[model samples]
Target: MSFVAIDFETASGYHPCSVGIVTVENGQIVDEFVTLIQPPNNSYNPHTIQVHGIHPRDTQYAKDFGEVFPEIQKRLQNQIVVAHNENFDRNVLIKSMALHGLHYEDLNIPNRWECTLKIYRSKGFKPAKLSDCCRVMNIALNHHEALSDARACAYLYLLR
Candidate 1:
């Protein structure tokens, strides 16, 4: 079965923010998508050169969640979506998407999910953080961008 692993890098902190996705097919990453979304209409912290490494000004040309989610939905349709903390990633991202008036219920795909964090824990692994697992698994994930993180999650999903 094919799957898409996803990760989100918020502006500063995590929660209620933008996100990205990495889709894997045939043991390869077929597509990568990123968006500069307007946060929960609340506030956007700092990700400048850090997690997302995106400055607020950089998002000037990028589309908000409302504009870009259609593409995200197209790719995710009927695909397995795996994440480190699958529920959290998917939930937060779903909520983040909602900021633009979109919801998972609006999608045709109905994503099937798996949480690598839970998987590792059930296997007696000590840590479930993507970076930590990548360290142990020898997968290289760049600091904190969405694509890199998603690829890392895909690698961990492979372990199972």
Candidate 2:
């Protein structure tokens, strides 16, 4: 089985400030890509900064999401994408791409994505935060770090 696990950290609202991608083939992670993204503008919310510890200054020299999307699509196109919270990540991708005048479908991403958060909840785990699920599954997590969260999500999905 081949799939890509992804996670996004936002600077403010739905603006993606960074991305993480872990590509799994035959159930093993084969590659990983993580990068900070310069959003359309350098505006970051303090609350979001506290959540992900990413500030505008950190991404000032980073590529824009538009510049980053090609690599992301190369990893994810026609592949099953997994995220801890599919809705939020998907929305972030959509909104951020739109801000760059790109359509989400233009990336040819797979429609059938998996949500590990929902998976854990359906398995009778309450309050399936990424950290909570990681604890239950003996997976290591660094909470809101995009790459750490994506890697944890990939491990969680493989265990399932």
Candidate 3:
């Protein structure tokens, strides 16, 4: 089965202002996609930015959500898309995309999902935070950056 491990960094709790999807097909990362978006609402909280180091000014290089949707759909097409916290990430994705007139059901890609955090917790692991999971499993991390976090999640998903 193919699985695309996806991760996102929001300007805030709003839909993903940025996202990274690591496409793993045949047990390898064959492709990946990252996109930055201008949020309809300035969900950029100073506290979160301290954790993520992104601000509206820094997002000048990103496309607005509407512009990147097509590319996102194209890349994620026909794969099992999974994440550390699949529900949370998918919820953010659904809501954020909704703001731009896209709906979750419309994203027909990635027909299956495996939430690594759920599997880890089910195994009696104490924490589900990606960094914490890394610590427990001895996977080093560069926290909060979408690509690096996505990379780490992909590795952790494989370990499971």
- Among these predicted structures, which one has the highest TM-score? 2
Indicate the residue-level lDDT of 68 in model 3. Answer: 81
Best to worst by lDDT, what's the order?
2, 3, 1
Candidate 3 residues lying further than 4 Å off, grouped into runs, are: 41-43, 109-112
lDDT per model vs. reference: 0.70, 0.89, 0.77
lDDT by residue (37-62, candidate 1, tens digit) is 65434346754345556665566556
Pairs that collide in candidate 3 are 79-110
Per-residue error for 50 in candidate 1, Å, reads: 5.0
lDDT for each residue of candidate 2 in 44-152, tens digit (9 for 90 to 100): 9899999999988899899988889889879987888999999999999888778778888876776547999999999998889999999989999998999999999
| Top lDDT model | 2
Candidate 1 vs candidate 3: which has greater TM-score? 3
Q: Model 3 Cα displacement at 12 (Å)?
A: 2.1
TM-score of 1: 0.81
**Cα deviation of 11 in candidate 1 (Å)?**
2.8
Give the poorly placed runs of model 1, Cα more than 4 Å off. Answer: 12-18, 40-42, 46-51, 108-112
**Model 1 residue 83 CA deviation in Å:** 1.0
Q: Any idea what lDDT model 1 has? A: 0.70
